[model samples]
Target: MSEIGATPDPGEIKDKIKAGSDRANALKAYVDTVSIKHVHRQDIEMIDLVVKTYELLTEIMKLVESKVDEIGNAKK
Candidate 1:
C-alpha cells in the first residue's frame, strides 16, 4: 500500500504497543495466580474425600478473606 497521505505518530504507536504489552502481562499474571495444574490421588473413600475437600475449601475461604483484608488495609 502506498497511500501515505497521513500516518500515525511514531511515539503514539510505540505507546500503544507498550500499553498492550503491559495489559497482556497483567492478564497473564492474573491467570497464573488462579491456574491449578496438579491433581494427586488420595486413597480416601468417596464420602471422606468429599468431607475433607469441603473442609479444605472452607479453610481456603478464610485464607482468601484474610488476604483481601490485608490488601484493603494496604490500599488505605
Candidate 2:
C-alpha cells in the first residue's frame, strides 16, 4: 500500500501504462471485427477518437520511458 498523496513510482506507472496499452489493443481488435458500414456514425467516430487517443498515449509513454532512462543514467 502507498501513503496518501504520495506519488507513484515511475516503474509502477510504466507497468500500468503497459497494461492499459494492452487493453486498448484488445479494444481495437474488437473494433476491427465489426464492419464500419454496419456501425452507427457516432459509434464509428467515437472508436476513431479512442484509437487516436491510444496512439497518442503510446507515443507519450515512449517519451516518458526515454526520460526515465535518462534520469536513471544521470543518477549513475
Candidate 3:
C-alpha cells in the first residue's frame, strides 16, 4: 500500500492550477470591466499598472500550465 502523506499526485497539482487559473481569469475579467474613464486621472497610472500586472500574471499561469504538462509527459 502507498504510504500516507506522500508526495502529492500530479492530478492534484493540476487541479490546483486549474482552480488558480479560473480565479485569475475571473479577476482579469473584473479588471477589464472597469471603465478607464471612470478612474480619476491621478489614479489612472495606478490602474494602468494594475492591468499590466494582471496581464503578466496570466502569462505566468500559462507557463506554469505548460510546465505541468511537461511533468505529466515525463512520467508517461
Candidate lDDT values, in order: 0.51, 0.78, 0.76
What overall lDDT, based on C-alpha atoms, would model 3 receive against the true structure? 0.76
Candidate 3 per-residue C-alpha lDDT over 1-76 given as tens digits, one digit per residue, 9 for 90 to 100: 2258875566777788788878877877877788877788767777677778877877887788788788888888
Residue-level lDDT tens digits of model 2 in 10-51: 677668778877887898788778886788989988988978
In candidate 1, stretches whose alpha carbon ends up further than 4 angstroms from where it belongs are 1-44
- True-structure lDDT of candidate 2: 0.78
TM-score leaderboard ranking: 2, 3, 1
Displacement of the residue 3 alpha carbon in candidate 1, Å: 37
What are the per-residue Cα lDDT tens digits for candidate 1 across 1-76? 2247854344454455556555655654554464244433442344345555555655655565566556656666
Each candidate's number of clashing pairs is 0, 0, 0
lDDT of 2 at 36: 69
* Model 2 stretches astray by more than 4 angstroms: 1-10
Compare the candidates by TM-score and give the number of the best one: 2
Off by over 4 Å in 3: 1-7
TM-score against truth, every candidate: 0.41, 0.72, 0.68
Write down the RMSD of all candidates, one decimal each.
17.2, 2.4, 3.6
Highest-scoring model, lDDT: 2
